[model samples]
Target: MQFMEDLKHLLDISYPIIQAPMLGVTTPAMVAAVANAGGLGCLPLGGLSPEKSLALVKETKAKTSKPFAVNLFAHSLTSEVSEEDIKIMENYLEALHKKYNLPFEHKPISSYRFYNHHDQIDILLDEQVPIVSFTFGLPEAQILSQLRERGVKAIGTATSIKEAALLDKAGMDAIVVQGIEAGGHRGSFIDKEPLPQVGLISLVPQVVDTVSVPVIAAGGIFDHRTIKAVFTLGAAGAQLGSYFLAAEESAASEVYKERVLSSTDTSTELTQAFTGKWARGIGNSFMEEMKNSGLVIPYYTYQNSLTAALRDFGKSGGIADIISLWAGQSASQSKSGSTEALFNKLIQQIKSDTNPIF
Candidate 1:
C-alpha cells in the first residue's frame, strides 16, 4: 500500500506495477490485459512504421479503457548501410545459413529502413495516448513538452545513474532504471562505449539518490521479495518482464516460453551477438557461436536487421538454437498464467507479508 501510494497515484493505477514493454514479445492484447489487471501496461512501438504503430494503439484502446503506456526506441537510426560492413556480414550470415541448413544469401537484406521518432511522436499526439515512454534515450525536450502540454505523462528508461539523472532533469514524469539484468536490448544511450554491468540493488538507490523524480526499478524483479527489495532500495515501483513471458497472454513463441521457464539463474548471459547491442538472454548455439567466432559487424539496429532473417528462419522452423531467447536471471522463478492471474499472484504475495522489511 505504501509503495502503491506514489506510483499508483502518479500513473493513476490501483497497483504500482509496470509491465515491461518487450518488443517482439509484448502484444496489444497483453497490454490491454495488464491495464485491465491494474498495472501500467506498455506497448513497445520500436522499429515500427507510424501506420503500424497506430494500428497497435487502436487495438489496445479497443480492448481496455484502463490507463496504459506506449513505448518507443529513442536510439539513433542508420538509414544507409556501409558497403564493406554489408559484404562482411553477408558472408558471415551465409556461412551461418549453411551451418544451420537454411537458405544462403549473397546480399544483406534490410529490415526496417527508417526509425523516425518525430513521425512516431506525431502519431502518439494524434491518437492522444495516455502515457508515452522511451528507451535507448530521451527525445528532445521540446517534443516531450508537447506531450505534456497535451496531457500525456512521459517515462524514460535509464541503465546508469547518469542517464537516470539526465532524464529526471529533463522533466520525465518517471524514470525506469533498467539494470544490467533486464532482458532484451539495453535501453542505454548515454555513453558511446559500453557501460559496466550494474545490478539492480547497486543501481536503484544510487539513481534514486541522484534524481528528484520517481524511479521505477527494472531487471531481475520477478517475485514479491524482489519487488519489496526494489522498494527497500528506494524505487517507487517494479517493472516485470520475463516473469510474464510464460503468461497465457504473452506473444512469446512456445519454444521461447519453454526455454525461459526451464532456465536457471545461471543459464542466461548478456551478449551483443543477436542485435549488436548488449542484452541478457538464454544461452543457445547462435549466441555462443557468434560470440566465439570473432566476426566484426555493424552496430545496434543495423546489425540487428542483418541478423533478423536468421531469427525469422529459426522461429518459423522451430529451431530454438538460432533465435534470441531473452530472459532475466530470475526467469526460473517465473510462472505461467493469465495476465490477471499473475497480477493477482503478485498482490497476494505482498499482502501475505504483514510488513515487507525494507
Candidate 2:
C-alpha cells in the first residue's frame, strides 16, 4: 500500500501503470491518451534530435494537461566500430538491397561524440517536463542533479538486481525492472557476455527487494491478471509496451500491428539483427539471415544506421519480412483499438475484479 501511494504521489498520476516508451513507435497522441486515462504516458526520445524532442514534448503537453514522462537512450556511445565487421555487414546488406531492388548507399557513419543527452536535458528543463526516464544506462550525475533541482522525477531501467541497486543509490525516484520478456532493446548496461535471462516472474521481487526506490515491473505484463500478479510480487507498478503496440494511436504500421496481433507464445525470439543490440521481436527473414551469416554484428548506432534503408523499404512497401516487428511473448493476447479505450478497459478490469489489486 505504501509502495502504491508513494509511486502515485511521485508520478502525480491516478494509477501506477506506465505506458512503456517504445521509441519510434510511441507518438504524442498515444502518450496523451494514456495520461488522460490516469496512467503515465511516455514520449520516447531515444534516438531523436533535441529539436525533435522539444517539438514532441510541446505537442504532448498541448494534447493533455496530465502528468507524463519523456524517455531517453542513455547508453554510453563508442566510435570503436570494427572496420572488418562493418564492411561485412555492408556487403551483406548490399546483396539484400539488390535482392529486394532497394537502393544502397555507403554513407559515412557518425561519431558517437555527438549523441550525448546534454541538449535533450536543456530542452526538458526548458519545457519543464514532469518526469524523465532512461534506458541502456543511467544519465550522468550532473544531469540527474539538474533534473532534481528543477522538480523533474527520474526513473531508471534495470534488467538485474545489480543495476537496480545502482540506480537506487544514484537517486532514482523509481526503477523499472525489465525482464528478458521485454520487447525491443535490452536495457542491460553491465558488460555481461550473455545478457541476463531472468523472466518477469523471477526478476520482479528480487529487484523490488534490492532497491529502496519503488519497483515498476516491465515485460510480458498485458492485462489485469498480469497486473495483479506483479503487484502480488511486490511491484508498485507495471509498465506495458507490447500491450499497446496494436493501439490505434500507436505508430506501428498496419503490417506491424497485424504481426503483433498474430504473434504466438513461440513466435518471438531475441536477436540483434535490427539494432546491433539484443531485443525481442517476431522472427523474420532479416533476423534469420543475419543470424545464419556468421558475420559479426556491429554494435548499436553503426548497425542501426547501416540497416535503416532496408527497414524503411520494407515499411514503405508493407513487406513484413524485412522490418523489425518487436513484440513480447504475450503479443497474441493484444487488443486492437483506440489507446484510451484499451487503457480504460484495463483499468476497469482491475477495479471491477472480485479481488481488485489496484
Candidate 3:
C-alpha cells in the first residue's frame, strides 16, 4: 500500500488500481462499483455525444460519491472517403451478408465525428470531474494546460517509451504504459509501424526508468502476482480491462463474456480487419474469413460502422464466431463474478502476497 501512497496525490484513490476504460463494454454501473470499492473507475465516452455523456456522468454521480475518470478519443477527425473506397467496403459487406443470409442494409456511411473534446472538456470542467484520460493520440498543449489549471488530472495511454516521453513532455499527470499483451487497439502514436512486442514485466521497469511521470502498468496483468511485479518495477498503479469485462456489472455482451471464459488457449491475434487499425481479439470465424479474403478496409470509424449491423446480429443470436471479442492476452484468467468480489479478491491477493514476516 505504501507504493500506492504516491497515487493518492494524483488520483486520490485508496488503492492504486484503475478499472480500464473499455469502450463499448464498460458501463456506468461497472464504473460506479469500482469507484465505490476504492479503485478509480472510468467510463469510456468515446461513443457518446456531449448530451448523452452529460447524462451518464450525472447517473454515475448519483450512484457513488467516489471519484472516477471519463475517457475520450483525442484522435483527429477521420477524413471523408472517396466513392471508390466506399464501393469496396460495400462490396465486401455484401458478400458477407449473402454468405450469412442476413439483410444487407446499405445506408450511406455517415461520417463519424471525433468526440468534440473541447465541448466535453467544458462539461467536465463545470462538473469538476477529478480525472480525464485520452487515447488514440495526444491533445493540444492548451487543452492539457486548461485541465491542469482547472485542477483536473490528465492521463494518456502509450505503447512505447517514446510515446511516454512525449506525454511527459506534453504535461500529462501520468502515462499508462500499455504493453504488447493489452487487448483492443494498440495505442501507437506516429506511424503504424510494428510495435515493440514487450511484455508487461519488461515494459514497466524500462518505462518507469525512462519517464519522470508516474507509470501505470497495463497489459496481460490479470492477478495479484502480476500486480505485485508491476509495483516492484516502480509502477504506481495497474490498469486492468479483461479481468473487469467478466464482472457481472460490465456491459460486455453475454456471448462475448462466454467466449473469453471458454477460450482454452490465450490465443489472441492482432488483426486490422475489424477496424483497419490493428487490435487484438479472440480469433474467430470472421477473423479467419477476413484473413482469407485479404480485404483491408478504411480506417476505424468507417469500417466499424460498415460492420456494426453484422456484429450486433451475430452477438444477439449467441454467435461468437463473427463478433469482435476484444480480449487481452491474459483473458483466459477471467471469470464471472460480482464486481465488488473481484475487486476485493485482487486487493486481498496483493496484501496476502506482500505481508512481511512476523
The top-ranked prediction according to TM-score is: 2
Give every collision pair in model 2.
none
Q: Per-model C-alpha lDDT, please?
A: 0.85, 0.89, 0.82
Better of 2 and 3 by TM-score: 2
Model 3 / residue 211 / CA error / Å? 1.3
Q: What lDDT is reached at residue 248 by model 2?
A: 90
TM-score of each: 0.94, 0.97, 0.94
RMSD of each: 2.1, 1.3, 2.2
Give the local distance difference test score of model 1: 0.85
Tens digits of per-residue lDDT for model 3, 8-28? 668988888889989878888
Comparison by lDDT, 1 against 3, better one = 1
Task: Give the per-residue Cα lDDT of candidate 1 at 160.
Answer: 87
Q: 1-358 in candidate 1: lDDT tens per residue?
A: 4544777787899778889999888899889988997888999898789999999999999999999999988776744456687678778888888877878655434534667567699989999898999988878889888988999999999988888888988899899998888888788887566675788899999998999878899998987899999898988989999898888988888888888888998988988888887888999988888878787756777678778889988888788898899888888887898888998888888878879532
Q: Which stretches of candidate 3 lie over 4 Å from their true place?
A: 1-3, 79-82, 107-116, 354-358
lDDT of 2 by residue, 1-358 (tens): 7898899999999998999999868899999999999999999998778888889999999999999999988886764778888878998899999998888898655433345466688989989998999998878899899999999999999998888898999999999999988888889888654687789889999988888989999999999999999999999999999999999999998899989888898999999998888999999999998999988999988888888889888888899998999988888888999999999999999999999977
